[model samples]
Structures are given as C-alpha cells and as structure tokens.
Target: MFNQRSSPDKLMRIGNILITPLLVIMAVVGCTPQPRSVDVTTNPTPTKLVPDMRATTTVIPPTETLTPLPPITLDARVAEIEALMTTYEQMDLFSGAVLVAEGGEIIYEKAIGYANREWSILNTLDTRFRVASLSKQFTKILVLQLVEEGKLSLNGTIDLYLPDYTGPGADQITIDHLLKHRSGIVGEPAVQNLERIERDYYTQEKMLELISGFELLFEPGTQWTYSNFGYYLLGVNIERVSGRTYADLMQERICVPAGLTDTFPEVTSDIIERRASGYWFDAERGFIHDSPLDMSFVFGYGHLISTVRDLYLFDIALREGKLLNSSNTNAIYEAEFRPIGDETCEAYVVEDGPASINGFRASSHSYIREDRFVVIVENVRSGGYYLPGVFEVGRNIAAILYGCPYDQPPPHVGD
Candidate 1:
C-alpha cells in the first residue's frame, strides 16, 4: 500500500510463493484416511446398519415317492362267495355244481345237494348236467369253423349237401338262416313235444328226418323263430361234409381244444361215476332216478353235458379268442336275440347274462351280473318248495354285495 504499485516480475514471484503452499495443503487433505460410514440419526443411540456378514448355504431334502399296491387275487374272494352257496345247500334247495371264474381263474366253486337222491350220493364238482340250448353255440362254432376253412359259406343252400331231399321251402333257407334262428321251421307240435320223445337213440340223420316232416312256419329270413330244426340241419351239414360222427367232431374240435376233460357229448357206462342222475316231475311218475337223459334226441339243439368249472373255462376261452380267431369270436358274442323279439330280452343289460342250465325237460337259469354280482340258482330237484326260495336268497346276497335288482323266484314244490 505504501509503495502503491510494484514491478511485474516482483508481483509474479510473490503470487507463486502463496499458490505453491496452498496446492501442497489441498493434496495432503485429499490423500488422508476417512470414516467408512457417517452417522445421520436424531435418536440418542446413533448406529451404522449392515447386512449379516456370516455366509450360509441352503440345502433342500429330496422328496420320496409313494409306491402303489397290488390287485386283489381271485382266490382271496372265492371263500366269501362259496359261503353264499353253502346257505342254499344247507336248506336242501339246490344241487349240482356252480363255478364262477375270470380270466381262466376259478374264483368260486361248489357242488351242493345230491347227485342221486335214491343212491344217497352227493354231487361233486365233476358231476355233469344237461346244458340244453347252450349246445346250439357249439354247433354254431363248428359251422363257423367250416366257413373259415372255405369248406362252406354262410350263404350256401342246404341242397348243396343234402341232395334228393326236396321240400316246399328248403331251397329258400340258407346256412346263415340256420345259425341266426331265422329259418322259421315249425317246431314243437304240441305243448311238450320234445319231452315225450325218446331222446336216447335218435341220431343226427334221424333228427333231420324228424325236422323235415314239419311245415315252414314263415318265409326264410323274413323273421327269427327259435328253431331246433335249424340246428339239426347244421349238425347234418357238419356230418356230411366232415364225414365224422357229431360226437367225435365235437370231442376232437371243441372239447379237446377247450381242455374240458370232464365235458362230453354223451354219457355212457365208462362215465357212470361222473354223470349226475336226472330227475322228473309228474303226477303218476313221482320222483324217479332216471339215468342222464341221452342228449342224442336233441343232438345239436339241447344236448351238452358239462361241469360248472368246465363250462366257465369254455366260456372264457371262447370269448377271449383263445379258441378261435378274433373276428369269429366276436360273431358269437353278438346277442342271439329270440325270433319272437320281446323288449324283456333287452331289459337285462349285463355281460355274460342268464345262462340256461338244463336237466331233461326242466332247465335252471343262472346269471353273473356286471360289477361282480354272481347268482347261481337251479332246480336240481323239481316240485320242491325250496328251489325257488334258494334262487331268491341268491339274488339277495348278490344285491347286498353289488346292488343289482333282486329276481322274484317261483314257489318250490316238494317231491
């Protein structure tokens, strides 16, 4: 201030001195250490917050899978069903064999009541029963087999085999008509025409002769009419083409293939031990011990002797296509509706429905419903009050287990 202004060189030297010291102090302050975090809190306790420093690794346990259980065996359920049959045996209501099976495995089997009440011999599983119209299925199979082999066709006429046998409506009928029960030949001349016939000695040829004498009930293929004559003609056709007795053909072709050792086309002295005595109900005859009524008269119509076990085996084997080709097997499974055609026939909607188990003139009906409901009822002894009630009891048991409709059985008459 006293000197006022200085020289340019002197002023520059004084500014450099001041600027060098200030730069040194600024560099020292930037390089010096500082606090990691600064506290900015209004509370009394001021603190720095940080995440947990200790490291951790998460591990999840593996999940365990649950295993499924096995199916119930047929053998396990057999005893429970056998108990139901036992009740009927105790009341003396039913006799003969009953077997229920699935997939070739016997689930329940029993032989109740007497095979021969006169001899006091009880029935066994091997005891045979006359399986009436069921024989038609066998005859049907034999014909179909011939069709498969090209030996015959379903459309072939009867005249192709049976020459010199001329009738008014014979040419109008075809082999297919016979298999389908549509031939409409008049059968049963009277109320029980088949019952009075001596069934012991009639042969296939004789059956044809008998049927040929009858009139045509309706035009062939016009409609179905249950015709034993039609099946008789089929038996004739088989014998004529194969040149083998009907019995031999059935034994070799069907019985052997099905492994039904106890089943046979006829009963003779050799099979006396296996045959069940036939019974009859008449005002004058009373209870009689008749030998197994010969199946000869009905041959291809109503003549088959089989045990329940053998029948079940045959049924499953045929249905499963183990015995025949799949197409042929399916053809047989298609319903054989009655020619008269009633709504009642369609009312029963279950697999393997009512099966006709026959004696001589009398036939028993048994059925195993879907959902595993089984009912086997029969008139082993006719005119006995207990047989009908036994069937009712069987239905009740089936309803309790499977919830199906109960069948009301007729009164059982005593011998």
Candidate 2:
C-alpha cells in the first residue's frame, strides 16, 4: 500500500519487462502443435487380430457319386409299343391283332377294331383272320420238312412228282425253282382270273388242270414270276409223296409241333369261332365287305387262317429249330436263285417276311442276331393303305425298338 505510488519511469520499466515475458510465453504456447482433425468419410485400416494357436484344422467331406440307371428293356419296349398302337387305333388307322416277341417271350400284344363290323364285335387276341400269302410260308416249311423226310427233293423236277401231268415247263421246273419263283410260268392270267374263279370250289386235281392250261411266260428258271400255281403244285406233290392230305400234313407236322391251336386250313363253308370278317377300304364308302371267295381257290397258295398268338408260336418254333434243322433253315434263308425274265424278283429273306391277300395282311420280322421278332396281322384290307402301309407299321415298330427314327403315317386323305 505505501509503495503503491512508485515513480513513473521506474513503473514503466517494470511493466515493460513483465509484458515482454508474457508475450513470449503466449507465442511459445500458440506455436505448439495440437491434435490433427480426422476425415470421417475415409475407411480406416482393419485391425489384425491374432488367431488362436490352439485351434484345429477345418476339414470338408467329399461329395458322393451317383449310379446311372439301366437301359430300356423288352418289357419297357412293350409298354412303348402299347402306347404306339393305342395312338394308331385312335386314329382309326389300324385293325386286327399285333404280337411282338423277344427271345421267344411275348413283349407286346393287342387287338384293335372289330372282328365282325356288322355286329360291332371288337377284335380279340384270339380272333382269327385269313393269313393270305402267309400260307406260302407254311407251304415252304412243309416242303422243307418233306425234303427232310425223304418224301421230296428240292432239286427234283415237277415232272418227278406229277408224272401224269405234261404241261409246258413242268418237266423242266424244279421244286427249288417253284419255291424261289424262278419258274417262268405266267402268273398274270391266274391272278386276273382269280376274281372270276374265286367263287367256285375246286379240288387239287382240278386246280392243277386249270393252271396247266396257262402258257409259260418264259423258259423254266429263265426269269422270275410269282406263281400260285407253282405252290399249288407243291401241295399236290406233298400229298402224293406223304400219302396225306395237305391239311392233315399241316396239322400233324406244323400246327401240332408248333403248338398252334388256332392255325388251320381255312374251310369257307365251315363255321369257325372268333373269325374276323374281312373288309375292303373304299375311298368313298370307308370300309365295305370284302368280295366273297371260296377260300378253296386260294388253296396252298394262301388259304390258312390263324391268330396272332398262333403265328407268334410258329415264329418261335422256327427260330428254336423246332420246325427244321439248322441246315435246312440256312438253305431256306441263304439259297440264292435268280429269276429268268427282265422282271426282278423280290425275294423273301429270313429277316423280313410279309404276306398280303384280298383283305388280309401279315408281317413277320426276325431280328435273329438280336433275338427279337414281331408279327402283325390286319384283317381289314384298307386298314393301313391310306395311312401307314401294313408292312410299314412293322418297320416303324422295329425302329422304335432299336431307338431309330421312323416315318409317321401320312395324314388321312379321305374323310
């Protein structure tokens, strides 16, 4: 308090010294660096965490491999065929019975359309139909059987069997020639006259007499022409050599051995059960009753009636060698005999055998190497004409079995 009032000059000097030191302290404090501002938008570096040293290694189990399925079997093929035929039936393109087999086992079977259209009788598996030219196959088999029994010789001339007959080329034509269609006998006349004569019943002798009158188309074995007369002559030879009727021999030697209960020589006059009435396809009328025939006129050429089941049995018998030995079967399949005329002969091989007549069609295919076969019989003539051909149906079925492409039936042309 007493020294509060100091001299002006002295007070000024003290104040200056104090103020200078304070200013220097303030500068030093301001110069010191503060904490830098952080940018919140920038990503910060991740913190590395030390893994636990005591942890065990992680393991992954492997995936399992799956097994593939087996291939399509005969049974499965049967189902496929069933579906296919059902489709055809819905289209009204198929009628009658079809039977397919593999290794002598039935794979597929079906009956479609009507056995008697007028009565609206649906066809059954047991329904019988005329096998038409399929009878030739049976006749051929019978001839081969006769050869085996020493009752006939393939090389023997027709004259050897029918010595009393003296027709043109009959002496020169051999059994083999007739069987192979190499006999140059004219067939057109007989075929053309069938409609006229089909109504009349003829005995074997009378039938031969009628055939003998036809002129030879060419020298024996010089050309090929289908001759029902040739097969008819074979039937006569079978009768003369075996001392049995053709029907009797067929029953004992073929039908009985093959276990074919429904196969027999057709007797037009005899009333038969489950017989299919034949129908012809008319472009305008759809389906009409087939022209009447005596059945006897077709004779050994094509006069047998059978069911698909029976035909299947016959096919099985053939493949199992129950009908003929391997040698004879081989000859039947492999024998090469050419025709003599300019007309090419379409020979029936073992792999494919087809037969057709007025209102009946039958097809048989032997896939011998594969042990598979198929048989199709249609009682209606125009059943397959406008759509799939009768034999084409069999081929299409085969293509399905083999997993191959097949042509579909054409669209129906008529209403």
Candidate 3:
C-alpha cells in the first residue's frame, strides 16, 4: 500500500495508522576479508564540510530570528505532538522527520527543524538521516537472508566464515551469538567509553586491530552483551560469504526487491541527495555543528543513512515476509528486548535499540497490538540537556496516535 503526505507543521490525520516504530541510521561502511572491522575514516577530511544548500528557507542573518512555522490544524493530538516537537526544537533536542501510518495508510507525516542550520534549510520529509544502531536490524535481516539461502548459518562460528580470524572469540562466537548479543565481545573500553569519540579519527586497519585484540567480557553464549564490534565482524563475514560488498548486498538483496530507494549503506565520499546536516545542541551556544567522524569503527552496525519513507518500506518488507520466510522474519523479535519506558509508561520493549551518535537519533519498533507504525529520525544530538530519545518520543507519539498508554515525560536533567 502507498503512504500519504508530509508537512512541516499542522499535518493531516488522513487515516488510522500502524503502531510499530521504524528505525533510522547514519554513516558509511567498510568490509574486510572476513570478521574484521573496516571503514575508511570518511575521506581525507576530519569532519564533513557541509556544502551550501539552496531551499525554501533562504539565508537568514545569523543574529536575526528565524521565521515561525505556520500551524496546520486544530487536531488536538496532532497539536500535542507538534507542540512537543516544537519544544524539543527550541531546546535543540530534535531536528528531523516523523511518519506514522496505520493499516498501510499514511496517517501523519511531518518534518521538523533544520537540516542544515548554517543555511537555514528546513528538514523535509525526504531528508536523509543516519539510523545509527538501527542499522543492526537491517544487518540482522541480511544475515538471516544468507542463512535462508544456506550461504551462512546462525550457529556458524566467526572462524567458519573468516578463516583468517584467530581472536580468542573467533571460534567461540557464533553468528547466532553475535545476532543475539551473547558473544561477550564488548567494544574496546577506551573507544566505547569515550564521551566524545565522535570527534576522533580512526582508521579501518586500526579499528580492526583493536577489536582483534579485545578480550571477551565473559564466555560466549553464556552472556548477552551488546557488541558493535561483533556486528562489524558480521559485516566482514557478510562480504566474505556472499562474495559481494555491503552496498551491493543492500542494493540487490534488500533495496531493489523491496522498493526501498532512499535507503543504503552510508559512504563517506559520496554526496547524498536530500541529505541532512548533523547537529548537536549547546545550552549556552544553541545548535552547534555536528563534528565529522572518520572512523571505520561503525561499519556494519551504525553506518547507514535513510529516510522515514524508505525505512517504512523496510519495516513493511519484514512484516509482510518479503525479505525472509515467516519463521525467520520473526527473528526480529527473537532477541532480548528491554522495555521502552519506566514503570509509569506502557510501551514496547526494544532489542539492541539505537543510542545517539553525533547528529542522529532514532526509534523503530512494531506490534503494540494495534498494527500501527511510528517512525521518527532526529538528525541532531543533545549536548546541553538530557533529551528524551527518539525512542521515548516515539512512545509518546504512539500513545497519542494509537491510544497506547503513556504519561508525560520526566525531565532528563543533564550535567
């Protein structure tokens, strides 16, 4: 079924919507021989230099106030969401797009805030946003496709795919372990714990070496530890087994067949169309430019860029069993899922959900017992205040849109 319309403010409630959340992701990817971390630290530049953009919103004097968005409707719930987003926008907590659909019909769609703050360019419905950790779900589907094709096995050890791998967990971590996060392979403490690694540059070779040397946090399969490096290794193995690149796999295996055009692996050098500039907020300074990242560190797990529409296609693909058999497609929920909000709210549990990176945040989930879909991609990060993540935002939207249970969000006080 085709979806409906989008607006910057005051969107129409065209019809009932699906209550599931669709994911968002960002960045490019790199693949190694097998089970190796890879990414070409995003070109020669240390940070992305956003080229000047021309759009509906023209240049505004840096010191001048921005023109106010005209409100579209008197719909109360829609107004609540619009108000919530506006508050977030003023607070520099969110800047991107949202889409909600029910029964395969578009119920609500809107873009909020700036895509390129320097240019005063408004984020449109089609603006591309990095899905970040949301890429893992996409990766999981690809892996299952291979498993379905008998090209890979869920229980296959890393060494089975990457004979070159000799790390301590190489033989111990199975594809299943990686998928379920039972690999015990946490990221390097120095890298993972860094508060600002987004500003640091890392080479593909260096990232690989670091992961190869990491000691497992515990025995594989006996523990469930989310590992980006484990997903990175899966990317390597995805390439090694299929004898294809990640982009190729995405284009052929998923995008082409599923009718997803604006979705693909992020490449550092390519100038993507309708791409949004990443941003971070500072309480004293307001919106700050999102720093450039040049690390191959996020290869498979985090380096994907997409739009709400294309991601909706992806969600539909999985739900309709277009990507895999019914048995395997259900694997999306087979992993460990932590509940969405605290005791005061009722929302779906999420598994390996995305955490914000530099300029992007996202939330995608399904099955709220209402056949609804709630997808939001926020292209800015919060630096000054504790911002409710897109996941929390999605939960609130779901409550309003599909009559799901939720309460007003508690303040996230930041240091």
**What are the models' TM-scores?**
0.66, 0.76, 0.74
Q: Each prediction's Cα lDDT score?
A: 0.51, 0.65, 0.64
- Worst 10-residue stretch by lDDT in candidate 1? 337-346
Query: How displaced is residue 217 in candidate 2, in Å?
Result: 1.6
Quality of model 1 by C-alpha lDDT: 0.51
lDDT of 1 by residue, 1-415 (tens): 0112322332212112111111111111111111111111111221212122111111112323423223434433444445445544543445556544332233455666656767667677666666656677778888888888888788988888765345547777888988887887765542254545744577555656766776787889999877776786787788888888778887888888777776666643245456767664333454554434455666676666766656655564565455567777756654311100111111111233233333432222222122122324233544422243333343344332322223332222331
How would you encode candidate 3's per-residue C-alpha lDDT over 30-56 as one tens digit per residue? 211112111111111112111111111
Error of 1 at 393 (Å): 8.4
Highest lDDT against the true fold, candidate:
2
Candidate 2 residue-wise lDDT, 207-265, digit = tens = 77777887788888878887777887777788888888899999998888778899988
Model 3 ranges off by over 4 Å = 1-80, 86-92, 192-206, 334-352, 402-415
Best by TM-score: 2
Quantify how close model 2 is to the true structure by its C-alpha RMSD in Å.
38.4
TM-score of 3: 0.74
